[model samples]
Target chain A: MLLAIAQPLAWFLGFDSLMEFIAFVIAAAVAYQALKGYRLSKERTLLYLHFSFVLIGAGLLVDGLSSIVVLLSQFHRGFVVLYALGYTINFIAQLIAYGLLVFAYLQQTRNISAQFAATAVVSALFFERNAFAELILIFLLVYITAHTAMNYSVSKATNSMLVFGAFASLTIAHFFFLMFILVPIFFPLAHIAQLLGFLLLLGMLLRVNQPS
Target chain B: MIPGEPGSSTKPVSKYRSQFRIYVDVMQVIQREKNQAKPTRILYGANLSHDRLIKYLEELKSLGVIQESGTEDKVYSLTQKGIEFMNNFKKVESFASAFGFRI
Candidate 1:
């Protein structure tokens, strides 16, 4: 794993796990909000949103746990495989989660068939400790960002703007992750950007639940 | 259930309104009319046919979300339960709308 060199950066390992944990909590909150909306309105789109965030939360939990395991083992050679496994699982989870989100958007736009095509291609790619997986995630986030951006443009609502900012930040974070291959320093930067993205989502959730 | 787009116009948006949504719509109309909505007002406000309006109004009353008053003209008003439900629904709707999902 390129991030295997994350050893010298070991001091930052615990922080990365903490960040992932925070992201997981925020994702779960978003999922719960979506579920509440689904129950009230019986909207299938809200159900999709619920499932997407559930997957995201699950992925973060797994990644954070594996990071803790690796850190506790003091980078033992036997436990090194856990890092790869965790990354692979996390990557796959985010891929499906984001893919489902894109489907929800496309379904709203009456573009159902495209989801199937994208899914078939994505399943074939699977997970790898390479740029391909990250690229796929970046692609999905970009689509979601564009959709939220269009929504913000139309509604001119603060909540919509927050969502657009969240996805946009996530997309940039993944780009930094992809660049981490060349510049090792990009690792912590990627995690920081990703945390910022999740924080934006938490802000949106809080604002939505505020009394009006 | 088919998920309708937020602002789509290909078909009647009301067709996609679920039972819960209808309930909310009816309650919103009553609230909008200063909590003293007439049958005709709700019929148009909720964009429901006369028959459906009566059916939903009856359901809302049975659920204790609304009450009917007046002997001659007849007026509808939201109960405390209905008011709270609408308040919570507003929050959920805002949350969903943030992500461009219509509920």
Candidate 2:
């Protein structure tokens, strides 16, 4: 929602390109913070995920600059090539991020085979163009769903319904965004869903870190 | 001098052993502070009681694991040893993660 509002406002003020560049820089900075946190905690897997975020942020920055250049120059072929390259870079970064997340999850659970299956699905979604991205999105949706279900089951057993509900909602919100990629019409909705998911995850982390 | 007098070396042995235990315990608590932490925060994190925590604080002050910040409203933070200890904890945390434990 913020991005949507800011993008047009920046354009109206003739600062759209500059604002986009700033946003990319901010995103990269955030990724850097996450990476530093991981290092402080010695979390290698999370470090990889943060590194992916940095790559993706760089790609977005490049794409935004290229778009601005194209607009100013009346759609130059070079700008188009640059945009495509940026897209490819961003896609690869996202793939690595997802891979590291799944790998971390599997390592936590001691489930090697399950991790492999998840990795394969993620790889297909990343490498496959056309409907493959959509397919991968569906796989992510199911995966998050199943993960939430299992967490909920444990929560029920442990009689921590409230905690379970919070986690389940977060997982659902995350996958909901992934589902949106299947239907491009809902792309904006996907972004909103992601924001909500992040907020919820943040809440959960705070809860975990609370002095008890 | 008498065997149990001030000149005897045995008197310092018991004091040194106790000091050594205090040093080890303080190091363990300091190692847990992977991120920056105030003395009170470290006190709570290690779950030390009031007397025990005070003792540790005093010992750490002498050894320089922590230093007092202000005169009126004093705050304490880690010194070099504390930082190194925390880094060691990070290494242990990474090892645990490899075994499917999210530290």
Candidate 3:
């Protein structure tokens, strides 16, 4: 879900929502592909991947809708809290989504129990609902980014490189999210980076399905 | 359990195909040969030894994805389910490969 800028950026009002909606579409498409794979092959890893992207898609949809609602409501005091609510939901969804990805990778190489990973995901729910949430997301993205980077190193496939670039972009996006607190300008930059990450994934998906 | 795949006991030495992967490989070889592949063709295409090929062929037959014909000079072809499976599998493979994963 990339935990977008969340708070109103003021300058780029409706445009950010549109970007997130586009990202949600990409995430949902990825999730749908994973679901098809799971239904056909019944692979546990594909199931994990399906759930991961579902959470991401759902989070983006919620956040985007909330932003649109707030904008339409003219930023009334009651609507301002909706932004915070949207952020918290997206943050939690990202924690679970990225946690599932990490668990899949861990299970691929090792035999870690699902219970252990579930515990970590649930524990993330206890984090303070503030900018500190971005830090936790950044930590998970670092692990996932490093995993994809290592995968690209070994596989040396263009698709793998694109996946790595996507996660790397997301990692940068979250960093920009963290930096946005100090400077509001970082907010739109974070959304742009986040959208770029999903777009790279979309590019890889298109290339993969190019009837080779 | 092939090495480098999920929860395998062995460490990564080389890309040893798992039984599931081998099943897909044989099926794909059948599909590649216009869905009416001979054993030698599957053997050459999937790079399997003769003994393993017979064993897998028997397994696939039992699973009802393939059937044998021509008792004297046997030929293999995919069943409707097998054809549908390959079609679905192609999409799945493409999707997983995009994420650097093998299914």
Each candidate's DockQ score against the native complex?
A: 0.46, 0.04, 0.36
Which ranking of candidates, highest TM-score first?
1, 3, 2
Q: Which segments of candidate 2 are over 4 A away from where they belong?
A: A1-26, A113-126, A141-212, B1-101
Worst lDDT run of 10 residues, candidate 2 chain B, spans B1-10
Ranking by DockQ: 1, 3, 2
TM-score of each: 0.91, 0.47, 0.84
By TM-score, is 2 or 3 better?
3
Worst 10 residues of 1 chain B by lDDT: B1-10
Q: List clashing residue pairs in candidate 3.
A: none
Cα lDDT tens digits, model 3, A10-47, are 66878888999999999998898888787766667888
TM-score of chain A considered alone, across all candidate predictions? 0.94, 0.55, 0.93
Mind giving the per-residue lDDT tens digits that candidate 2 earns over A59-135?
Answer: 55665666566566554566556545654565555455545555555544545655575657455654654345644
Candidates 1 and 3, the one with greater lDDT: 1
Error of 3 at A187 (Å): 0.5
Tens-digit lDDT string for candidate 2 (B1-103)? 0001111223433233333334444556555554344557666766667788788788767766666677666566677766664454444343323222233
Docking verdict class for candidate 2 = incorrect
